[model samples]
Target chain A: MAKTRVPAIEGWFTTGDEPALVGSRGKETGSYFFPKSVAFSRNPAAPAEKLEEVALGRRGRIWSFTTNYYPPPEPYVAPDPFVPYTIVAVELPEEQMVVLGQLAEGADPAALKVGAEVELVLGTLYEDDEHEYEVWKWRPV
Target chain B: MTDVAILGVGMHPWGKWGRNFVDYGVAAAQAALADAGMEWRDIQFVSGADTIRNGYPGYVSGATFAQALGWQGAPVASSYAACASGATALNAARAQILAGLCDVALVVGADTTPKGFLAPTAGERRDDPDWLRFRLLGATNPAYFGLYARRRMELYGATPGDFARVKVKNARHGLTNPNARYRKEVTEDDVLGSPVVADPLHLLEICATSDGGAAVVIASTDFAKSRGTKAPARIAAISTVTPTYPNTVIEMPNFATDSSAGVKPPETTFRDSIAAKAYDEAGLGPDDLDVAEVYDLSTALELDWYENIGLCKAGEAEKLLNDGDTTLGGRIPVNTSGGLACFGEAVPAQALAQVCELTWQLRGEAGERQAEGAKVGLTINQGLFGHGSSVIVIR
Candidate 1:
């Protein structure tokens, strides 16, 4: 089996620990991706969406993406701080929704185009004293 | 409604000072009070635009600024509506004056922004869209801007050159502004030469974050006359309006747009919806505008504002821009104070700063960047997550 993806942020994954399976309560679009991720909740019900998992087959084109030139934020220490990684917005064919997530390791976002192929993967985000919020990520398929 | 006059307007310029936001705000507030010939204690009310300070303060901007100004026991109100924070503060001041609650009120906004991408404050919270975008998509504000600019290019046939010219025009205008952050002129070649942070948009096409503060003193018409002022540039309207839902549009700091599942979206774009509310309230149309100040977070967004503000019809921003209509001395000059492009992004203070520019232009005191014979002016700004602001001013 493919090496299990490790969570970038701990406890955000639904399946085996995978950096690809970061999970969060999907917002209004009703897919497995955050419509807009925020540090605080806009609605009272948002806290419940954290760490919930649904189907992941949704796929979409890369709307736009960027590569990490620096360490993303605190609590996320990679083996290499400057390692190149991609983030993509994949349009899900069945759900007709788009999910945003970090690209699989070694994927280059700079070379990707707007309509590039993309799919969802579970991800691992960092965790600390507070919480470990993981969710879905996008990668070129 | 009671008429209100601007007693004073002051700023801490627009640049990175590497200082705390409170310092900038206090400086601007003091200057405005001095200009208005009043002490800080004389002010009856204080309004502040909310910001993300070093410590988590929620959005208690009014109390924050009041504390910075040394707490004069005045009624404090903190207003948060994303980019419209400044204007919302202004509105609060106007309402206080018109309601006969207070004769003079101070409206201020200031921010000492964090370097690089503006992210949600720490701690894992999957519920907030602003934070989720960073954690999941790693999407920066520029990415949304790039997406919009690309969409503009695809839909409106706006070329990268067109986007570059916006920077050139705004920079030329900024070159004359004493308070603008970037005063040097930028050429189209300079824009093209810069590396593309997002495809179709070069580095020069984006705005940088800055530490800045702006404050305005608003008093009633009688209060201004009593203070020996004959005629002050007066505010006609402050539009702190929200968008009509289902918004059904993809905007900054949001991953997906309104589902369009529940209800029909309005015919006007979200930005335009803001201006429409202001125009309706002020009983003024776009044709009557002498000049305009818009949020140019990026080169393309400025063009987007042009259409939204009714300066031109949809998809014709490039035509107006190419004709030199948006430059100083054009039929309706825009961003005569160099706009966010030259001023950099100062968040809460930016929207109020737009009105400050208008007050100066309407008074014909803009010097090098003056819009000749300007009578009526408008400032349009929108904040992330659905906070929209537009203000109309007339001399």
Candidate 2:
């Protein structure tokens, strides 16, 4: 039997055929915020304005990328035998913002380059006996 | 703003002593007081830079230090601005002096950090971006450094060898400094040969976390003159500005950069504006700098700072380093105290340590690492969130 798949952090991103990050947009200023700033706008010009939840662009260009050779400290959960992973900062053109995520599993770090296009996908951040923890990751387009 | 004189500066050597942070802070404060030729009672204000690691005393650091030094009922203020805490404390003290509330002030900062990478406050804090980045993406401090270093490589053709050269230069600079933690010289081969912590950033290319403390004694110029202390190193300006709206760059502990889709980005990038504000306040420019101390969290970040602080134009830092313009004997020597590369990072104490080095250089007290005829100096550093710090000192 397969283990249950669940989001590592709930409501931050959608897991499906076309995964997209959940972001918030300022009604007045049109500024976008990731992880959805529901309380108020972050922009000083429109601080009191209401923010609306919106889906961010699913695809972006790789602004820059790097591979981590060592495991990060807690609250980062590493596997028993740790495997290195590549992290990417992707520039979403429509949003004019840069968002960070780990490169999807099986994606080649050597093939990654600045300005290369990548799309959002769901991948395992870590797993336990009962469940597979999912997170938003980037994959080469 | 009127200038305030830095009458004395002192520091406890940077090392992992695994002792109570108060020991370091009290030692540095006493040293600064003695160096200023003033007793504890002379301080009208005590401003402490806070450390989050040491529990309650670290939180109320100003009162903590004051009580330890036998409180004279001096007014106290404690500041916490991540790595810029020290400068924040200094800014608070300078404010009181300029407001005529205090004639003399003691600014102190100390830290007792953990062994490995600086981690976020312990908890299941999903809302906090600092924790979110660590838990969700497992992005450590070196991850951000790796991103910036790779960007530099992609943007300016900066090589791993170029990054290695930075450690080599700083190690050589650290050799002559007594207070530096890593006092031995390091070759480029040594740096390149070290383990790779982050891609494009070797283990040696990154700074370490160490326990340390630093302090400064400052006073109104009039008060300094009355004390017969003439021609002290004066703080010409202190820039504690925040990032303007639409900060496009991805800073530490943040998962995303601000969206420029709605609002256009600021005219000056956040990092550039840090020193620009100080230059504007001091009525000075990059050309006026005789020496400098910049936050070198990673070797490649130093190259980024060369452009950020206007030492050279963007993409020209590698060329500047190649020309030996930022070395100890160069035209405008930077990080003559060996910077964070030598001292490692002690959070609250790091920024004040930069100021301490500048004061020593401006006063011609820096013996071996001294930049000859140094009269003007600048220090620039940034902390997490939106805290920006830059201070200019002139003799």
Local distance difference test, each candidate: 0.75, 0.93
* TM-score for the A-chain in each candidate structure: 0.51, 0.97
Model 2: DockQ vs. true structure? 0.90
lDDT of 1 by residue, A39-138 (tens): 4322333334433344445456765555544444432434343454555555545434445566765556556777778766554454445544445666
Q: Give the 10-residue window scoring lowest on summed lDDT in candidate 2 chain A.
A: A34-43
TM-score of structure candidate 1:
0.83
**Model 2, stretches more than 4 Å misplaced?**
none
| Poorest 10 consecutive residues by lDDT, candidate 1 chain A | A36-45
lDDT string, candidate 2, B20-89, tens digits: 9998899999889988999999799999999999999999999999999997899999999999999899
Task: Name the docking class for model 1.
Answer: incorrect
What TM-score would each prediction reach against the true structure? 0.83, 0.99
